[model samples]
Target: MKTLLSLSIGALLAGSSLLSTSALAATHAPYTHTQFSITESVQPADILVVLVPENAGELRLAGWDRASRNHINRAIEVAGFDGKAGAQLEIVAPVGLSYGRLLLLGTGNPADLTRAKAETMGASLSTWVNGTKAESIHVNSQLIANAADNHRISAALAHGVELRNYRFDRYKSQPEARPSQRYSWQVALATDARSKFEQKQALAQGVFTARELTNLPGSDGYPEAFANYAKTVLEPLGVEVTILGPEEVKALGMGALYGVSQGSHMKAHLLVARWRGHDDAQPIALVGKGNSFDTGGYNLKTQAASILRMHTDKAGGAAVVGAVKALAGQKAPVHVVGVVPLSINMISGDAYLPGDVVTAGDGTTIEVGNTDAEGRLILADGIWYAREHLNARVIADIATLTGAKVGALGSAYSAIFTQDAAIEQSLRQAGELVQERVWPMPLDGYDGIVRSRIADKINTGSPGAQAGAIFLQHFAADTPWVHIDMAGEAFVSSASGIHPEGSTGHGVRLLTEWAKLYQAKQD
Candidate 1:
């Protein structure tokens, strides 16, 4: 377990409302790292892994001696292990090898081994290795026929291993201890994949940070704490962070956001974090809805299951900061701005009630049909601020905003709403590559869903998910924008794939990859 180290230091900037600092330090729980060495030779280890492709005729064992190959062949013949993807075979005390164990990991087809598939294979490998007590392992990466493809596949596998190792045990009374001894990980490849692997490591770091923040209980996960985290984690990496407390938020005329904050004794805040890897390039904005803990305001949630995990509502904000951390950590040449509006929608005497209308930062009026629909209210002002004040070239707001989205897409995909076909296509491609996939939802006919008789727009509408998208789209105006309703994708009910049974950290990779692609196109 790790905690924030406190210091009696404070500063004020940007007016009476902006509080910014770089001296704060918040340490996260220590993450595990396997001591990996890239090499051309397969060193002797307790466990030796041979890569077996489905096309056995095309398989090429780079460093295996004749004797070792004969023994492996005999084992393969005996076990009837044709190299199908996800198939595994193990032999203990092999005939010609002194190793304690020999394992064969299957690659479906060398030609079909994409980065996504490689990551899946790596995840499976992590699980298999964790079940064993081996102290070291050697992996052979010579199964693929193409050298460039081999390097990329190997790097993606290493990334998968790192991602699967993430565990959130901060509050566990006796957290399960991982294997104490430092495990030695050696990989034999024709070309060095260390640089590629390190880039993936940077992404994993961002994902880990996003997961940790989302897993924290509402008691510890608050607006101030998140701001402190950004200052501590991102500022050192050269990102500029600014924290706007309740006063600042109200002073900026973000009435819709301020209305939602009145419900909680704990005030709301707006956090602005910017990472500028290029001086003159226009920055893209990543706006995340930071509802630290939502009690549905006056329209309280009746079921325990619905309210038990509301702390994860802040997952979107965590991912935005995480993506920025990743881009800045690698010093990627892109300018990105992150706008997160942090608030807790708890019931109180002063809480904004249903049917109330409030003006947003951009002077648009919003009627609160259902106080439970608070995410879009805060995001409304967040998007407006990003576009009007920050001068962002494109705006993408991600949130676990609607339950209707879950019914529409389920746990497999997130729902994205955008008018621009290019933005939609780019986001989908990025999501597919990173495995945080997005499917487009209709935004045209849904405009009527948010049309309010009493205000500029209604926060809640008939088709819940599309209504939320259209509500935020009003704030985005004519800018290239996308509204990602990740209600189904942010947190998982069960562990699967590379994600554990908790916050998936879904948007961090998607946003980071999209930003990379967007910047490349700009050049």
Candidate 2:
């Protein structure tokens, strides 16, 4: 009932090739370009992108000559473009340009350049440039001096542009009435680090896959459906895929996950996808909480507003499926085992009550303080699956776990819970590089919070995030693990930057980069 969306893998060049006078190519463009069009390959560019950094007084047009620089500056002043970050000025028929139009892109400061900004700039470029009919546009990243920085910045920019060019109009009844994907055009971007483009493209594909899966309605993307998607896509890309049915999960003592699904019509599942890039090393474990739909079971979110957006509750599982797709497709030199426990927390005649006690995969009893707090129960089983079945050495689990986390961080960061130094540091570095930021919170001091009179632990407490993480820690035992609460960051209410108006695909980039970091350190 679901279809895999087409992904574009643009042409990659080794270095900058000479452009004719009509092409408006930069002399110092160090990167060889990849020719990619957002739509089909038949279109041509409508504009050209040139970046200018802001200095003390005037804009620093490093690559442009004096005459063209003055003309661009005059146009900026006339258009009130202050070279501010995300500011733009359009010029028609400038003094020295190959294309008829010019886009004055801004970088606040040269020294403060980051991958996040690069991605934003790239998205800004697509949002503005793709608004026009120009099919092919070029990016000039010549001003950046460091070859590696140039490569990262330029590739991130292109990746951003590619990300923003997405649309999920599958369920629209009047699909034709819905806006066609117009923010898609051919893009010619240059970067000296050619491999970075391949990697970034792979990462973008992962993000896109996650977004698409999350965007699907609950009726189309139940637990079994998601498992099928993994095998359909990842298996073809050389990833080993496994789907554990409710009986299989129950037989393995995944009581916590099974309890959450007993109320729903669809049976629960534990899906695993493995990429064995390095046979000699143990694969890093990635776990996701895949609650296809959270009706809150007995403690239901009866409010219309809360129930409407419950379809996105499975973002964490969608991300695991996506990351493996990218890594396997790219043939990344890393080993990864992605685990996702899929279930729908719905209300029914047999729905588990709020006060019900259940034993988990690790044989620990849990008092279900609130059925709405069900993400952690599934993740508990997932963590146990990673350790007992996969023999995980390092694990990271992502979920839309706690409303408290969103209240604390808004939509900016995922609340990270871990006590491991190396894993925490690597996650932080990866978050910064890819901009899916993780803010570490405490793992201890939760013993008294989730304490129950009868059961070993209760599911909810005053501080929901800490208690949820602590509950999961019981299953992880002594393994190095990190719990990421992505309640706010995984889905959005409006279009912004690289994210469209819906599913944000928040954890894909961070996990992909972290896998790369782990692979690098181990090798």
Task: Please provide TM-scores, in order, for all candidate models, with all chains considered together.
Answer: 0.91, 0.85
Model 2 vs truth, CA RMSD: 9.5
RMSD of each: 6.5, 9.5
**Per-residue lDDT over 178-294 for candidate 1, one digit per residue giving the tens place of the 0 to 100 score:** 532222333434235556766777777778778877776675777777776767777777889999999999999999988887877777899999999877456899999888888
Clashes of each: 0, 10
Off by over 4 Å in 2: 1-44, 53-73, 76-87, 95-98, 108-111, 143-146, 174-192
User: Cα miss at 392, model 1 (Å)?
Assistant: 0.4
Measured with C-alpha atoms, the lDDT of residue 69 in candidate 2 is 73
Worst 10 residues of 2 by lDDT: 23-32
Q: What is the lDDT of residue 41 in candidate 2?
A: 21
Report the lDDT tens digits of candidate 2 across residue range 235-338: 65688998999999999988899999998778899999999987845679999989988888888797998888888999999888778877876788888999
Predicted structure 1: clash tally: 0
- Each model's lDDT comes to 0.78, 0.75
